[model samples]
Target: MIRGIRGASTIAYDNPELVMQETKNLMERIIRDNEVLPENVASVIISTTADIVSAFPAKAVRSLPKWEYVPVMCTHEMNVPNGLPLCIRVLVHVNTTVPQNEIKHIYLNEAVKLRPDLTK
Candidate 1:
């Protein structure tokens, strides 16, 4: 069966380097926490808050080892009043036998507040 794992992270500034690093960090956590292998990943959808325009998070993802062929897309998050700033979110679809309730989700930095119940 296919399952979706969610994750989010925040960057301190709009610097391109930071955006790339933070995005990589979030993806790594999501992959590790969920024990997801790249070959099993169906696709990854990434979104950044309006304030994050320095770079596409997918660029960072593509640079990772074994991630060159994983289908990935990036978009801008919907602007909402009082929404978290510099936040990047991702939904990763993967083929796995694990039950949906057992899948792990990752939320780092200030983005943890976005899903208080899921963050540990």
Candidate 2:
């Protein structure tokens, strides 16, 4: 079965390294929490708000050994007025044996404010 997992995080600055580290941390938690294997991940799509264009968050994620084989794509988030700034979001589509309701979604850092109910 194909299941979708979602995660979001915010960067402290436009620095590529910081964005990479936070994105890595967020993705690691999502994959680990859901017990998702790299091979099982069909695709991972990431988006950053308009204010963040220093680097593609997916590039950092793909650099990780655990995610080297996983397909990744990055894009710009919709430029809605008064939207969250410097945020990165991910949508992961995985071929998994787990049920949809069992999947764990993560929202970290300032992005946690986006969905307070989802964070631990």
- The candidate that wins on TM-score is 1
Candidate 1 stretches with Cα past 4 Å from truth are none
Misplaced by over 4 Å in model 2 are none
Question: For model 2, which pairs clash?
Answer: none
Model 2 agreement with the true structure over 4-113: per-residue lDDT tens digits: 89999988879888889989999989978998788888999999998887878888778877778898999999999988888999999999888887789999988888
TM-score per model over all chains? 0.97, 0.93
Pairs clashing in candidate 1?
A: none
| Per-candidate total of colliding backbone pairs | 0, 0
lDDT of 2: 0.88
Compare the candidates by lDDT and give the number of the best one: 1
61: Cα error in model 1, Å = 0.8
**Lowest lDDT 10-mer window, candidate 2?**
60-69
lDDT of each residue in 1-120, candidate 1, tens digit only: 999999999999898999999999999988888888999999999999999998989999999899999999999999999999999999999999999989899999999899999987
What lDDT does model 1 reach?
A: 0.93
